[model samples]
Target: MPKKKSTFFNSVRFRIMAIMIVLGIVPSLVIAKAVIHSYEKRAVSLRISNVRNQCDILCNQLVGVGYLENPSSKVIERQLEVLSNVYSGRILVINHSFKIIKDTYGLDEGKTVIAADVIRCLQGEVTSDYNKKNKYIELTVPIKDPEQQEQQGVMLISISTGEIASSVELLERNGMFFWAIIAVAVVLISYMASRVLVKPFNKITKAIEEITDGYQKEDILVEDYTETELITDAFNKMLNRMKILDESRQEFVSNVSHELKTPMTSMKVLADSLVGQQGVPEELYQEFLQDITMEIDRENKIITDLLSLVKLDKKASDLRVEHLHIDDLLELILKRLRPIADKRNIDLILDCFRPVEADVDEVKFTLAISNLVENGIKYNVDDGWVRVSLDADHKYFYVMVADSGMGIPEESLERIFERFYRVDKSHSREIGGTGLGLSIARSSVLMHHGTLNVSSKEEEGTTFTVRIPLSYIP
Candidate 1:
């Protein structure tokens, strides 16, 4: 239970609730304090006013009877008693000599109360004090003869605030009650707001989970919000890429199985032919053995090409880059394949507009260029020619291999770079082609941040263009 509660406080809901509480409560506390303080001041003010009015009246009656001249009079005592009862506090009457002429409480009668306020009252001033914490009101007013315009005596009053103190406390309690209700409302609002905000994300998570579990077939739909839409779009794109990779992997496995099986099947048939033919002619046996060896070599080449493709597909594969003459590279590739070209009487030519130097993977680029030129020679007609061209600009070097071969069909051009894709399966097998040559060539060129392009006409010829940066960037 404590674990769940701990998680809840760490969750978005709690953080949002905490924020709302601070936003709602800090100001409320300050406002309540101000209100209580103002009530305290107003309570003191009202008591002072009430006592002032009663004291003024008593002072007038005393002046009319000349009570200060005779403090022991019964009439003045009765008036003082009435003033004390009405105001609910102490009352003291002081003469101009700063002597307590009359005291309603009688505790300070005949005492000389020579206080600052008493002296100020003797000089014809009124003063009041209010103690908010203790809750009391004190006031002093001077008695004056209107005709002579001189101070005759002073009236001082003190009032208890028992009712006001109790009322202020009750106000605080009621304010706190209202605040409690407000806090509950804020909690509910924050909870609902956080829930509403998080609903889309929850839906997204559920949809992704379904996709992961193979239950969902369609892209996640959460376009009600921009942020969620962006998340959904990115996730769906990555999902689609994974799907493509999975399909490609399955296809690759099938193709590899089929390709490997074919060579083994051919070797098996050749072995069976030797086994059945007892005392076979030496020349015939040699031919069969050569055929078996060729098939084995073909199998090895296919495996090698597959490994190369896998390396090229990786993001972190490093290139052994070197600055070498592009012209020399092409000559080296053609030199190796020239004998095969000679067997077909196909003309092999190098049309170098200018010698080009580029930073490239020495062995990989030679293999890639060899694939292009070798294909040209292998697929060309007898007495036809294969032309290799090297050209360059400030930024990039270009290699073009144009051939007088039976070119690829227009529709098949795009799929030519796919693994094990062949336009003419019979001719490909006859030429011992694994159909991965173009794919490897393209991958190698692209690894150097280059481009491989082809333009061909069916039954006429084909031209391959290779563009590579003059200097490798990485």
Candidate 2:
């Protein structure tokens, strides 16, 4: 069983659920709080307004009956008694002297009610308050005397606010219940959405797992989303490249074994023939030793070429770069290979259009151009001409090698640079060719970020073009 990580808080579903909860619950709570506060404020304002209106009506009646001027009137006392009872709180009537004329509760009837609210009301100001914790609304209104054209006294009324408080509490409970339901719905939706989003990734995991277990070499054909498609495309390309490299490696090993064993077997047979002979002639002995020496040289040449190709195939980070002349480099390669060409009577020619200076690893570049020119001389018919040309544009310098050789066929052009690939196997072996020269040359040029191309026609001629940047980046 696979080990499980502490990933519940890290998973997609959990994260989505967390986001939904924040979206659903936080806003719901804020709106609920705002609504409750608004309702409470409105209810208190309505209660205070009602008390103010009730106090105004009673104050008008007191003024009409001349109650404040003569407070001992039985009719005024009865009216005040009824008003306080109906409003459900005590009422105080204070005159301009700030003395309580009559208290509906009968306790502060003959006492002075000197309060800030009462003083303000006597000066024609109205003030009110609702004490939510104590459950009461207080309002002080002016008692106007029409004859005096001013407030003659103040009427203070205090009423209970239990009903509005009870109703608001009920509404808050209902809002919370509705929000609870919405939060649950958010959780369910987030879970389903996360599942849908993560399904493709789960399938991709399975595909990779199968590959890891050494099961399939097929491309993962997932086309669910654009991101997944890009991933699959890149992964399939990498997989194809790895397979090609692996196959190439295996074929190279098989070819090396066969090639190395052939010469060794010949040497062993020749040695055994000498050993079995009682009196081997001096001439025979000399000939056998030369043959063995030739085979040894051939084997050593193959190993040396293989090593050079291996080194050339490495990354360009190892290049020993310096400023070199393109013309000089080409001249050096042709000058060295001219002696070999002279033996076969193949004329070697060089054409320089302009003198170009470039930043390149001189040794690697020289080896690469030498391989091309050498092949041109080796593969050509007797007395054929080999031409080397150098030209450059603003961006890149070019070298073209044209030879009147037995040219390559159309189909074999592409594979000609592949390692150990030979057009004529017998002729290649007879000419002491190890079949790694072109491959090494191409790799070396490519390491310098260059392009090498070939165009040829059978029995007519062949031309090779090499393009290299004037500057080396790395």
Candidate 3:
């Protein structure tokens, strides 16, 4: 269960769901809040306007009928009572002397009322205010004498906001209920959307799991999105490469077993023949021993070449690098293989375009170049020429080994660097070739971050070019 929770939190689906929820719900909530506050503000403004209009009418009547001077009008008094009852508020009608002539509540009649709103209204400026905490609206309206163009008195009104408060409460409750439904809908939609979006990735995962579990080796197709298509292509390429490597490993093991067993079998046969003989001739016995010894030597050579290939295949960090003159290096390699070339009556030549220096592992570099030059001599026609050339640019040094030899077949050129691959098997065996020289040489060049390429034509000749960086990176 804990693992499942961790997986969910880390998954793309959860992130998508979270993003959708935030996008869908947060803005609606903000707008809803703004809308509620706006309604309240607009409602208060309209309420204040209506009350002010009524007060203005009453103030006009007071001045026209001379009601403030008389103070005994039952009609005006009843009207004031009705207005106060309708609005559930208090109203005070004051004279120019600041003496209240009529108080609807009858609590402050004949008394002086001194307030900033009233004083301001008496000076021809109407004033109004709302106290949110107290839930009330307060305002003062002026009584003006029209012909005189002067202010007579101020009528102060304080109205209860309980009605607006009730409406706001109802709106808030309804809003909460509406948002509850919206929140649930948002969550459901986000969850469904996330699941739909991640479906292709889940399919890709299942396909990969099947491959890793050894249940399937076929390529997968998930083109629901462009990203999924790219992933599918990359995965299929990796799977195909793994398949090729697996096949190569199995073939290598089989080849190693066969090659190792053949020499042993021959030696066993030679030993058994000597043991089975009652009276073998000294000369024949010596000949049989020589044959057995040759098989043993062949087996040893195969083992040695295999070990060299293994070492070359190791990490490039194992290289013991040093700067050496590349032209001189090529000269020394040719000198070492000159004896073999002389035995075959092959001319070994070295040409240096200019003196060059490069960082290299001397032992591995020598082995790689010697194999090329020796192969040139070993596979050449009688009295054929083998030329070793050296050249250099700013970044890299180049070596070319060209020989007048029975060149490689077109099909065999590609597999020449593969282990135990030989172009002419019979001739290779006759010349004591173990077929690992090219593979070892290729591995050595690769370790130094270089490339070895070959071009040849049948019964004509072959040319091998080696390029290595002047400086070793590692």
Q: Would you estimate the TM-scores of all the predictions? A: 0.85, 0.80, 0.90
Tens digits of per-residue lDDT, candidate 3, 278-322, equal 899899899999999999999998999999988987888899999
Q: Write the per-residue lDDT of candidate 2 for residues 1-474, one digit (tens) a residue.
A: 998795878887688778877887789889988999999999889778877776777778888888888876787778777767776788888888888888778788778878999988877789997899988888898988767868788888887777888888899899889888988887788888878887887888789889978935588877899988998899888889888898989999998888788889999999999999988999999999999999999889889888888888677788988899889888888888889999999999999999989988888889888889989998999999999999999989999999999999899999989888899899877877888889989998898899999999999999999999998877
Top of the candidates by lDDT: 3
Q: Can you tell me which runs of candidate 2 are displaced by over 4 Å?
A: 1-15, 49-65, 73-88, 95-99, 105-127, 131-135, 141-153, 160-199, 215-217, 221-226, 265-290, 325-331, 354-356, 393-395
**Best by TM-score, which number?**
3
What are the lDDT scores of the predictions, listed in order?
0.87, 0.87, 0.90
User: CA shift at 450, candidate 1, in angstroms?
Assistant: 1.7
Clash count list over all predictions: 0, 0, 0
Candidate scoring better on TM-score of 2 and 3: 3
The residue pairs found clashing in candidate 3 are none
C-alpha lDDT (0 to 100) for residue 408 of candidate 3: 93
lDDT of 1 by residue, 1-474 (tens): 455554777876678778887888777878988989898788778777877887787777778778889876787788778767766678888888778877778788888887888887777678998776776777898787766778888888887777888998899999899888887887788878888877888899999998988934888889879999999999999999898899999998999899989999999999999999889999999999999999999999999988888887777258889889888888888888889999999999998899888899887898799999989998889989999999999999999999999999999999999999988898788877898889999999999999999999988999999999999998
